[model samples]
Target: MVYYVAHRLFSAHDRALGARVAEHLAAEAGADAVFLPFCDTDEEDLVADVKGLRLYQLDTRRLGGLTGMIALLHGPSLDDGVCMEVGYAAALGVPVTILTTDFQTYDRAGRVPAWQFPDPLIEAVAHTVVRGSTLGPRTAAANRFAAFADRNESQIDAAVCHGVDALLHAPAPVRPAPKEQRGVYIEASPYTPDSGLLAAARSSGRPAHVSRRFTAGDPLGAAVEDWNLAAASCALVADVSGPETPPGAAILIGAAAARRQRVIAYQPRPAYTHAPGREPNWRNLMIQYASDLHATTLSDVTAGLES
Candidate 1:
């Protein structure tokens, strides 16, 4: 059974999205998906008739039946209970897929994050992790659970499809990157441009791309954009600088680091910013993050990429 484990996205507040996602995944996954959308109540914590077990009994008894897990991550932080579920699923050798909305991107593609990195434990275990967004007319969470799914339906659908495919396939799940990736992928920011860095990346004689290039053909082709330059490249160059530090670059650093990818980081020097020490602690955090190949200059970064 494929366990659909989630928290804030479910609960009394956004249960509608929870139910809709549950049903949609069940339909998409056929008989392999097993979801329990039962809410905790004064009457009971929720008892599943399948094995006549209560919610608390999941870890002790039924968790052994888990083949895979799909986590819907959102809100301020991932809930403690859901984290426990992922842990249990992990102990049971159940592969996990994390679909998140909290890490919304600067670009509307929902392909990546603007900020808010996922848990390292999640990164290490989950077979796949996808960042998603509401994208269209933003809808406020209802006071009570609503009847329909929100504008995030398609994004949710895509995430579920990946999770199900991963679940059904087990050990060898489909990955974001191609088996034989081409060159280095350089990520850019919003307020500040990375054109200088882009040129530097290309000078290394490896294929490189910026966000503008990622969305060239289709204005909002984050999903339809077949090749994620980040995933396709041997390494990635992230310049986390400018007037206001872009959250996307920070979160991208985390994701890339989590994947154990060779990341070349180039940040504005301390003198470049008026606020002292390269945008305060943010740069330090990034330095510690991409310490793998933190470069002092664009030339140095390109040199590292070439080597």
Candidate 2:
């Protein structure tokens, strides 16, 4: 069976862990082939494309053809790219197994409770979550990773294999295509009921669904509902005009793109910079590439409706 293994590839340590997982999946977990994004870069033309559009397309196309996906959920905060892949895979009805070996926790003495690892939205869409050793020092980075891997390698291998086997043997479900309705789903932070974009979509005679309207008061439930709305809509207009792209919006954008829906990302201005003379943060490459249109104004966002 072929599997797409998603993991952070920016560091040597990250790459090593990815390689180890891919190797175990192949040699021991009954996988015939494992696609590693970092190692599978054959798109010479898109190699230096700064916008990252072609590269994202290439990866998603490859991922859609895979049997399943295994994503590594490591680091203090989960990698954004990996989360996007998980969302995309989930939207396609592809089984996803999350492997997290990081032993970090965010619980505080007197603060609102927080998840020990991944956000609940991520867990909600995953088929399996294979958690590794939670018995390691919080610091001493390199040595800690080595020791953690040494202790949890066998455990992880067994869990991952079991999950893959179950998923492969499970009966496939029929996934109907989205209804041919020209409705627009708007994903925005601090959702406004009468936002100009929503108004514009309605004025254009397209039925519009605001993400906040689907809130279920529970994170997981809300995420699932919002995702469903995004899937059902013909287009998704995301307002990313903030310091950072909202995680939920990013996930929706990825899912929408995976379904080949029109994704219009609106970032009215450059992201806030902490100090003057410092470079301003831009929208993430994943969002830039996944979106069919990158709108810098409300009018640009509205123009997408006509297309």
Candidate 3:
């Protein structure tokens, strides 16, 4: 069975760890068992272009066809792209196995809540979570990962193999018909402007559900509610024109794309303040790649609603 391995690829250490994990999995499974995005040559040309939309399309399309997905959720903060991939896999009913080596606790007040690890939305969707610990600096963690994998090989193997069995046995989920699905789900950071997108969606004669309204109060419950709205909606319009890319937006975008729902990533312009020597209009490649359309204006987003 072929599996898609998702992890951070920006840093040298991240790449090393990802490569090692893929190699180990292949050695245990088969040479062709794993599909690593960084190693794929299908989008080699698009990799050099900053505005390469096809690269994202090709990756997500390949992901949709995979049997299962294994995601590495390491580092001080979980990689945003990996989080998006997890959401996408979950939404598509593709069994997911999350392997985390980061031992740092994120719980406040030293008390662990039900949603103690990472974001509640992510934890809620994962089929299995395998935890491992690595000592020493972040730079050395990758080199030491093979030992951790060896120690936890049985657990990891069970999780991955179980996914295939569960997928084969589980009944396919029911999806709403095009006419039955009505609303447009609007997702945006509290710091960004969404009123325009909201207005545009409403003007198109479709019901608009704002994510902020549904994602308040209890964290776990809110995450469930937010996910429900996203799954039920006919389309998702997300505004990422804020100072930083909202983690929640990234999750929703991935989930929406997985459902084959229309997704419009709204970023009117580079709204971030960059330090000297840094690119001004930089945005997360995953967010842009997963979206059906990259909208620069309310009209552009509105056009996507009809498409």
> Candidates' lDDT values, in order?
0.52, 0.66, 0.67
Superposition-based RMSD of candidate 2 using all C-alpha atoms, in angstroms:
5.9
Model 2, 1-307: lDDT tens digits are 5688888755787777777777766674464577888676543323442425555766887767767787887655556667778778777777788777655543333365444443455666777767664443334347966767654655655555654455455434334466664689988654333447787667767889877522344555665677777888999987765445655566677788778888887776666332122223356556667788887777777777876
After TM-score superposition, what is the CA distance of residue 195 in candidate 3 from its true location, in Å?
Answer: 6.0
**Most TM-score-accurate candidate:** 2
In terms of lDDT, model 2 sits at 0.66
lDDT of 3 by residue, 64-104 (tens): 77667778776445576777887787787777777666566
The count of residue-pair clashes in candidate 2 stands at: 0
The digit string of per-residue lDDT tens for model 1 on 50-90 reads 22223344333444466566666665444434544554454
What's the C-alpha lDDT at position 237 in model 2? 88
Q: Which pairs, if any, clash in model 1?
A: 114-247, 114-248
Q: Each model's TM-score, in the order given?
A: 0.41, 0.73, 0.71
Give the better candidate number (2 or 3) by TM-score: 2
Q: How many backbone clashes does candidate 1 have?
A: 2
Model 2 lDDT, residue 60, Cα: 80
Task: Mark the regions of model 1 whose C-alpha exceeds 4 Å error after superposition.
Answer: 1-178, 213-219, 223-227, 242-247, 270-287
